[model samples]
Every structure is written in C-alpha cells, then in structure tokens.
Target: MKKIICLVIAYGLVFTPLSILFSCTVEAKIVSASSVLSRQQAIDFVKKAQKNQWTLTEKDYFSLSKVKSTMNPYFTSAYINEFVNVGGKNTKSGWISNLRDTDDVTGYLPYDTPGKEMTVSYSKDKKKIYVTGYANSEGDIYKVTTTLVKTKVGWRIEAIKWL
Candidate 1:
C-alpha cells in the first residue's frame, strides 16, 4: 500500500504540471483565435490614430493626458509612455513634446493621403504585425513603417516611424 501511494503521488506531481501547461496553451489559442489581428485591422488602426487630436501646442494644458486617454484603446502602455507627454514642466520627453513645440500641427503620423498602399507582415508567432505604407502630405508622398503588437484587449500600435 505504501509503494502504491508513493507511485500515485509521483505520477500526480509529474502529470499535473503537464496538464496545466497544455490547458494554458489551449486557452491562449482560443483567445488568439477570437481576437485574430488582421492586416486590414492594422491599417484601419493607423487611419484612426491619424484622425485623433494628438497635435498640441505649448499653450495647451493637459492635452497630452487627454490624447493618451483617448488613445488608450489603440496604443500600448509603453508606446503611450514613450510618445505622450503629460504636461508642461512635467513633460515625459516624448514625441508629443516635439509636436507641442512645432508650428506645423498638421504634420503628424499617418499623414492625410489621397491613396492607399499599405503592406502588413506578421511575426513568426503572429504576436506582432509590421505595417509599411505611404502617406501623401505637403504635396509629397512619404513612406512610413508601423509596428502593432497583440494584447489581451486587442491589437495596439507599438511604434511608428517615417522612412
């Protein structure tokens, strides 16, 4: 009886971890399937972000906070922290800081363009998306690259750069 009990306990310990791991993997797959991030979704997010009132002037008070709050649905925390400045005298040294100092408020990300030619690529694990597109602004077309990361809430922009 003692040997039998020891054998059963040993088997339980080994199998319990394996079962938990498998279940977690299955749950992740289910979540991913339900929230599958597609190329169209990424493109649409960029367009939406472009329309957000992110341009702020030096005189604008707490504008960055408002933008960050408004953009919370579409951007990751890290991205917001890196790009959104809180306010004057306590600026986060982010992209919004530069925008606040710039005279051209219209010169923002995802510049208003007349046409569309966005390309999207997924990471090997499909947890990240890379978007490249052209934006027409100031009577010229420029290339822009953006990265989107998959999160529990949905897909959010990680980074964007002009190229």
Candidate 2:
C-alpha cells in the first residue's frame, strides 16, 4: 500500500509541472495565432479584392451592375459602386484608369509580385483594419491603402484609396 502511494506521488510530481507548462504553451500559441491570423487575413483580403479591379473596363462588358456584383463580396454595398466606370473613361479618373490610364493590360498594382510590400494597422476597437502597401520598380512608385470593416459575415473592405 505504501509503495502504491509513493508511486502515485512520484507520477504526480513528474507529470504535474509538465501539464502546467503544456497548458501555458497552448495559451501562448492561441494568442499568437489570433494576432497573426488577423493581419494575414487583411493582407489576403486586399490582394484578392484588388485583383477584381479589372472588371471595371470595357472588354468584360463594363457594366456598373457587373462591377458591383464582382466587388460586393469584398466591399461594403455603399462603397462598391464607387469603383465602377464605363470602359475606364476620364483617363485620370476612376480606380483602374487613374493607375495605368488603360485597361488592355496590367496596371501598377503588381499583384502577387516581388515589388509589392504591405503592412497592417488596426483601429482602437479592432473593428477596422488598414492594409497599406506599395508597388515599386525602377523610378516609379505607387502606394495604396485598403480599409476593411469587420461585419457579421466577416471582414469587408470599406475603401481602396491610392496615394
């Protein structure tokens, strides 16, 4: 009986601190995962959302309806309509035209390329997130700021401001 009691105490001593340390490690991982996840989500959302800017041009039957429909999933309804322009007119106006002045090919955004770099910042309440990035090569530099709002479904972009 004494041997059984001693074995139980030995097992408790050997495993108790390891269990405590394991729990602490798990908690630390949880905190780290959440922080990293939010930042990555903001970046990924901007990359995916920005790629749809091509829908604003004429080749794809540039309809305000189509533009809104394509972007609505990523942006708020009130702001989705702001990006639409028929055939990318006005040269210096609208999002796509303002970036490259043409819709036939790639613009300055540099999707998934090495010349782009981005950073994330959050509002005090963490309800709003800003993903700021730049695409640069040679002598030209184009910067953009993408703002996102957390919603019931998930995060939706509020606006894409070029700077």
Candidate 3:
C-alpha cells in the first residue's frame, strides 16, 4: 500500500504541471508579411527627413524611429544640433567649432551636411534597405543601409551601416 501511494503521488505531481503546460494557449499576434511600404513611400520618408520634419504616420513612426536611432551618431547629430549664423564672420575655426558644438546636442558630429539627392532601395524580402545620396557640405556621396525586423511595435531597424 505504501509503495502504491508513493507511486501515485509521484505520477500526479509530474503529470499535473505537464497537463497545465500543454493546455495553456499561447497566441502569436500576426502581422501581414506583405505589409512593407511601397518604394515611393520609402523615398518620401527620406525626403521628409531631409526637410528636418521627420514626419510619419503612426504606423511608419516605429520603423522611422528605429532607423533614426541606428544612424551613425554623427549623421543624426547634425540635424539635432543644427545652428545658423546670421552675420558672424565664418572662419575655418568657426566652422569647425560649430561642428563640434553640434556634438553637444546629439553626442555625435555629422560627417557632412545634408545631401541634395536621395535614393533608396529595399530588398524583396523587405528585411533590408539601402539609401545613397550626396551631402551638401562634404560634396561626397554616401550610402547608408539598414536592416529591419518586425516586432510588436511594428517594423524596426536592427542595424545601420554608413559607407
């Protein structure tokens, strides 16, 4: 009788948690795999950023914020700390100082000023995007690529590379 009782108790204890674990329902929220933005929409987002507004619909904001956060700190910092001189004599030192001052606001300094032309391309899987453009200050073209993933908050950038 003792042996049987112990066996039953052990079986009960082991199966009880297993039953609960198997019975519990976990539902994964599903988003459309085909919900990525059209090519035009992506380009428009860049244009808006160039204007310094960085405006986006609520849905796009999540994705945009991810890209903004991952951008080379220097590139993003230029916009956040932008300053204009009205009449101050623009010496080489003044320009360098201004660039350094921008670091105070964004904790990074831009490699160059805003670019004139911008172009973007996205992978068919919608997991990667590449942007190439010219900067007004540096007079050199740049290519920035970002990787994205979908989350509960929507699409977000996972990484950024500047070339």
In angstroms, give how far residue 82 of model 3 lies from its true place: 20
Whole-model lDDT for model 3 versus the true structure? 0.38
Q: What TM-score does prediction 1 earn?
A: 0.60
Q: What is the C-alpha lDDT of each candidate?
A: 0.62, 0.57, 0.38
The candidate with the higher TM-score, 1 or 2, is 1
Please tell me which predicted candidate would have the highest lDDT against the true structure.
1
lDDT of 3 by residue, 49-160 (tens): 4333222111222333343453322133333223222111134433222232222212221233363555667777665555555433245444554334434444433433
* lDDT by residue (tens digit), candidate 1, 70-141: 668777888777665332224444334444554342324665545777899988988888888887655677
* Better structure of 1 and 3 per lDDT: 1
- Reference-based TM-score of each model: 0.60, 0.57, 0.35
Which pairs in model 1 have colliding backbones? none
Runs of candidate 1 exceeding 4 Å displacement: 1-34, 53-59, 85-108, 114-116, 137-140
lDDT of 3 at 148: 41
Q: What's the ranking of the predictions by TM-score, best on top?
A: 1, 2, 3
Worst 10 residues of 3 by lDDT: 1-10
Model 2 misplaced regions, further than 4 Å: 1-37, 55-60, 85-116, 136-139
